[model samples]
Target: MKKDDQTVTEATALHSFDAMLTTYERWAQPCSQTFSRAALDGAALPVGATILDVCAGMGALAVPAAELGHRGWAIDVSPGMIERAAERLKPHAGWSTEVMDALDLHFGDNEFDAAFSVLGVVYFGPETGTALEQMVRVVRPGGVISVVNWAEPLGATFFIPVSRAVDRFDDPEVGKFVAPLTEFLEGPQLERALSGAGCVDVRSESVSGHFAVPSAEIFMEELDSVFQVLPQYRAAIAKDRDRFRDILVEEVLLMASKELPPARANIAYGRVPTPQETVGSSGLATS
Candidate 1:
């Protein structure tokens, strides 16, 4: 990403979630609480393990991990978010939160016993390729790596049209910001990425959960305000703001007419191969 693009991304994030910190937890309550435990369980770290929570927002998993007897180190790009997380997690001695980009983690090699990013990695898109590599590099050989992404089959249906609309109207330089939205649509693709990143026994499973919003209009409102959609669609919003919102409203209202569950997602799990194991003649390691 270019410096300008990075700047825009950072600003957009700070404006979106950081600015809305008062409402983020309430808005995200359903999904975060529903899926966070599964993510921690998937890591299956023993007692006292040191864990990294990438893109950690509001210390959702970070605080809980500390309570579970692990050292939880959390990082995010938003200073406001870091501040809020630090405040919320201050009472817990086993946790700490920092402001940093996930793609350029500054920690030394094998610095963590395990690492996980829940729903957060998806925002980084293919950039997550580098983020995952960073996780692999920092975690000790054989440490577990896990991520939870919005699965296409169930989760994307509600949001795809909105993302597509943004990409269609946004500047060409941005080049399909929604493309990363489908990065983990297929479990096999995610598994392959993990394998390519030198993770062994890679596994991705569709995890089902539900979001209960009062109405379709409220859903659209929160989707635009609470989530990071505003940043991706910033250009379009500037170009014709109300029209963009109208388009999303129309689409979401149509989906809501179905009267089904509001949301669902998938979780992918893998482990960095231990140093004693050889991956292939390619000079990597495998479990």
Candidate 2:
């Protein structure tokens, strides 16, 4: 991506995240925390390993890594997110946070023992591979690079109600409002991205869990908090927010009665090849 386009993308992400900052912990952090722990387990990093958390929203992954005695940097595009992450990491030393773009990591090459992102880089759209490449670039050869992304079908259960609600609206643009948030990368696709970025021994596995909201009312409230940040959603409902909310609530309530399905994620990890290992793989190498 061009520098100008990167800047625009960062600004847009910052705006959306800042708006979600208020309800983020209550609505999203629980699931993020679950995935973060899973990612850390999958990484199997040595204690005290230096780490980098790309697009580290609210320090979900960083906090767990710190508890495991791993310390490093947590970076996000939103100042608000970095600020919140900093607050969460204050209890643990040797950890810092910065408002940085994942596609443009500022740290030196091979500076970290491991680097990871949890449901963060998948939103980069066409720039997703660039983001993964940056993560691979900063980790030491033989160090781990890990990421957790929502898997398809099951990964999208939570949003099904939202899509159903959008269908109630006559405007076609209503569908576009939720499109960005619903896109997901499957396990094989994630593995390819990592391998394409020069990571070896790549592996991906499916992780499953539940999303438990107390009630439909809470679900709608959380969904509303998220939608408030999305300009497309705002524009789509500009005519009658109340009516849309009502329809959304109805759809959510109906879905809730049927029991929300298990949420599943693809946790993928791979290692950067060391020079000796790289050479060994090439025919030019001699014993």
Candidate 3:
């Protein structure tokens, strides 16, 4: 990605998350818990190990890692998110948070014992691999790296309202604030991203779960809060705020009325290769 595009992406994310600081966690409790659980489970983090949580929104995984006795370092683009994460992790001495870009992690190579991102890098449009490589760079050889991304069909279903609303209301020339979820949906595509990032022993699994959403009205409110910062979304809202809200609410209710089961997410895990293993496999020696 160009430097300018990176800046825009970061700014866009920061704006959206800044808006969500107070209410996001409460609204996302269900999906957040599920994603964090899956990422942590795949992590299998040893107690006291140094772990990095990239795109660590509100410290969902970081707080738990700290509770589990891991020395946790969490990063996100949004200052608001970092601030809230710091508050959540304040009780734990081993936890810390930073506002940084995931695609350009500043830590030295092999700095972490394990690293993970819960639904983080997959939204980087075409720069997902660049972010993943940076993540892999920070992990110690043999340390685990895990990521969670949405599954296609279920993800599409979940976001159908937003998609339809955007198509109908937003200008076609405007760019998407968030990339299509399907960009990172397939399991093999995720595996390839890990392998391409130089991670070894890559594996992926599906995690299916549901949120006991209270009502369509509430669900629509929370979901809308997440992406209102998107230029196009904001533009559409400005154009016809009430109609946009009404349309989205109606569409969300249609899905909620069906009471569909929880959709599945694909979780991937991989290990950074040890020096000896790297040498044996490719005749390459470590520094």
Candidate 4:
């Protein structure tokens, strides 16, 4: 992908994450437990099916799917995430890993029985309509495509408050962050987008994020991991790195203390519409 087309400072973000992936994966087990269950429930893949895990960070579901009667092709954009996925899925017989973009996935038409993204697809790009169409296109007509993402920001980490804090960026083609005023990429927008993208019986629900963690220590670690995107998080704030960290930490602590509400999710799933019908949906930027 072109430098401008990808997420900002992805290399630095990877390095920042190198030391934390293992810790975060371990810490993520609890959250993953919740997401995986909800994801499967939402997508309801048939056994012995082929699946694609997009933005398959660290192969969380890809690795498990190997042992769960399904095979998966795990594709990621981040080199670091791909590296970690390789290591994690090494012993899995039904898993393969590759580096790719969600916006433009490389697969023949109707390539798999199902596709699932876990809290991924946070950034569906400027053409969410096209991205959703692409993701749906990869699945068989009667098969399923499910996307998992935070519907709102109620806790320590989310693109919402930070987007609010910043001067309302309009970079819809890349980052998950966007102006609250934008009508094309939100709750109702998501439903319209999915339906428009030719996904039938499309729906979403609240899943996971309500349970507590082993401790606040693990939570803090994950917080720090994502915040390493200081430069990308708040570009101006990063001008004075130390000061930025302090400000971000204080704001996050406040959020953390605010009773980490259950994570809300929009788990949309439906049969991939036939290509003929897919061409007729009416909508724009329904991510």
Which candidate wins on TM-score? 2
The CA-based lDDT of model 1 is what? Answer: 0.70
- The residue-by-residue lDDT of candidate 2 on 1-287, one tens digit each, is 33323222566778878877877777678888888999999888889999999989999999999999999999999999899999999999999999998989998899999999998887676788898889988999889999888875324455666666666765765554344344446887788777777788888988877766545677656666565544445665786777877887788788878867777889989888888765233212222
What overall lDDT goes with each candidate model?
0.70, 0.78, 0.75, 0.61
The CA lDDT at 198 in model 3 is: 77
Candidate 4 accuracy as lDDT: 0.61
Top lDDT prediction, candidate number = 2
lDDT of 3 by residue, 62-104 (tens): 8888887889699999999899889989899978789999988
Per-residue lDDT, model 1, residue 108, is: 97
Instruction: Give a tens-digit lDDT track for model 1, residues 1-287.
Output: 43343322433565567666765766574576566677887778899999999888777778778878889689988887788789878777878788988878989999999988777765564476777888889999879988776665325344555665666555664345543343566667677667777788788877666554444566545555544553566666666778767766665666567665545666778888886776774424544
TM-score of each: 0.76, 0.87, 0.82, 0.70
For model 1, name the residue pairs that clash: none
RMSD of every prediction:
4.6, 3.8, 4.1, 6.5
What does candidate 4 score on TM? Answer: 0.70
